[model samples]
Target: MDIRPLRCRDFRILMTSGVVTMFGSFITIVAVPYQIMRLTDSYLAVGAIGVVELVPMVLGGLWGGALADAMDRRRVIVLCEIGMAVLAAGLLVNALLPDPAFWPLYICAGGIAALDGLQRPSLNALIPRLMKRDEMAAANAIQGMRWQIGSIAGPALGGLLVTQVGIAAAYAVDLATFVVSFVLLAWLRPAPAPPGAERPSIKGIVVGVRYAFSRQELMGTYVVDIAAMFFAMPMALFPFVADDLRSPSSLGLFYAATSVGALAISLTSGWVRHVHRHGTAVLIAAGVWGAAVVGFGLASDVATALVFLVVAGAADMVSGLFRQTMWNQTIPDELRGRLAGIELLSFSIGPTLGQMRAGGMAAAIGLRGSIVSGGLLCVGACGALARVLPRFTAYDERTSPHGRAETTEPVQPADPGQL
Candidate 1:
């Protein structure tokens, strides 16, 4: 991966903070569900965690986008980090209680989800300010690697801590990570609102939404990603897939396979900076993800199935890298936060809906049938989207008007204000 972005002091600080927080955040990711399952023993109650968090996250993303545009981006991130730390404390305290209440899990989970939604648009929007535009692909790859590392390590450690030491220990570790992240994030330079940026309002949010839809290439990214995830995301079916393949003990591998693949790509992502046709890259990656899922479905052995899943994961990582690059390279600073909000939804909502789609389809068809059918549908959707949105596929970063604008007119920090 390109290391030029790391040369910037602010970028280094932000990346470090991200690395610490992601590890803590992911530990909580495992703890929340585990605690809920232990307390209620109801799959429905555990599943309802997603439902409970969804609305708040959606509202938070929209409002947070507006907030990021209206305030100092660094301040927004710092405040959210503090809020998250408080939530982590809440979880820690509750876990320490002799008789932990069932309801607190849902409350903390929802609150954290909202805060995460709020913090992310600011975080995503802040990246361009931290480094040169040409280094974005490398930066994105590095960030992706950070996430995969956290996803893989945090959960494993979380499981071990929760099971061996107790749930309170897991929450404590998460809380500590937040405190460390807060201090690091506090050191970053101010990223003030764009000049003449309007105060966050429903009207402003609507305008952002309108702008996102008005751009055909932007729409292509959103629609293609949604379709790919909605049709091909099979996490909900992983346990069943393992059973079907007669490797129930290897179920964890199914979950880890994609991350491993994504990590491998991130490790070797130097070539990504050479690619100019980001749109084409995303389209190809999504199609490959679909194809890999189909191959996974058809595979009769665990090793074969895992190979396909890894390919799918790597493809998804490629798609994500370019989608992020496109948004960063094309979007105006004034609208970056709000667009990042929309970008969050395009990626977040898809997987939620996808699991639902997977479960419903698996019941309607058999396991392999659901996986196979969904993969086919994903590919078909990509083909249809490509035909309709030719401009997106033809988009070349070196020559596109938006990319040219980004290159010619670099972003400048607005006058600093009190955080």
Candidate 2:
């Protein structure tokens, strides 16, 4: 198959924005929980932050997705970035306050999450407009690579900055990244609204919801992803592992190992492009992820746990590649933003619910037992999805409906007047 990348100028701007945003986002992810821990010295308080963040993210994704479809996508992204920048500045101010209240931290985190909800779908919808039909896979691969690279660097850098410089310094770095991202986004021309787009309204939001749920393949992907995240999220247990199973230093080591594994797979972008049965690859990777989670739960030594985490990250990277490709390719340009919103909603809900469940189960049954049970259930869920969506297992990129390799011609640029 002949695959090329998006050559459009706006796509380059958006991709550059993604790199900066991901790095800053990762830094915040590391710094936030650590800051909460230091302030309250309570695990429940940290978990509460997750809950607060999830609510706004899910709500914003639905509304944002609808708005993206009805308005100019580039403008929507810029507005979202600006909101994020303001929130980051607020965090910096709060840090400097004489008595930084816990409630303020929670509010800032929720605000950031809401802004991200708006940002994610707009960006996902913009990719196809930038590329030829045949280049969707490669474009998605580049996105996956960018995410993994940011994930690899962000936490380590955040940790170093917080440990050496201070927590406030980490937030300042994040604030700076948002500034750079906003500047890049400002340079890009706006993406034209889809043909015949209507004025934005609540009815438009309902329409997007209706369109997204109507597609079988898209719905199937959502089902599988929700199932995977609900049963497999191990984030709630990280602190326990650091405190009980290993030293605090080992926590960073474990995260670094996982990032390295993901980075290794992402760097081999060429290899991912060649995979034919992408859906099957996703299923197989999910199974590996389950097994690795189980292995980590049972591991007695820090070395063994780190090894299992590396395996889990590798499996995660593979699964992410296929899942992203499936979503980006199957959705139509007109509905991509809303569908991406629905996708984000489903994605966020699962982990949010999972963390609550994990925390509760760990309290009742013990951390190891909770981890083991979740992993086992995840593996079983994958098998169940395979049986139900048997055709999904047979999906091949070469035979895509958008255009098979033999039938699809390169996209001629839209008329200069239209652009």
Top TM-score: which candidate number? 1
lDDT of 1 by residue, 377-402 (tens): 99999888889999999988888788
lDDT (C-alpha) at residue 316 in model 1: 96
Candidate lDDT values, in order = 0.89, 0.78
Candidate 2 lDDT, tens digit per residue, 13-121?
7778889989998998888888888889997898788789988998889878877777777778888888988888887787777776677789999999998898788
Q: Against the true structure, what is each candidate's TM-score?
A: 0.96, 0.89
Q: What is the TM-score of candidate 1?
A: 0.96
Report, for all candidates in order, the number of backbone clashes: 0, 0
What lDDT is obtained when candidate 1 is compared to the true structure?
A: 0.89
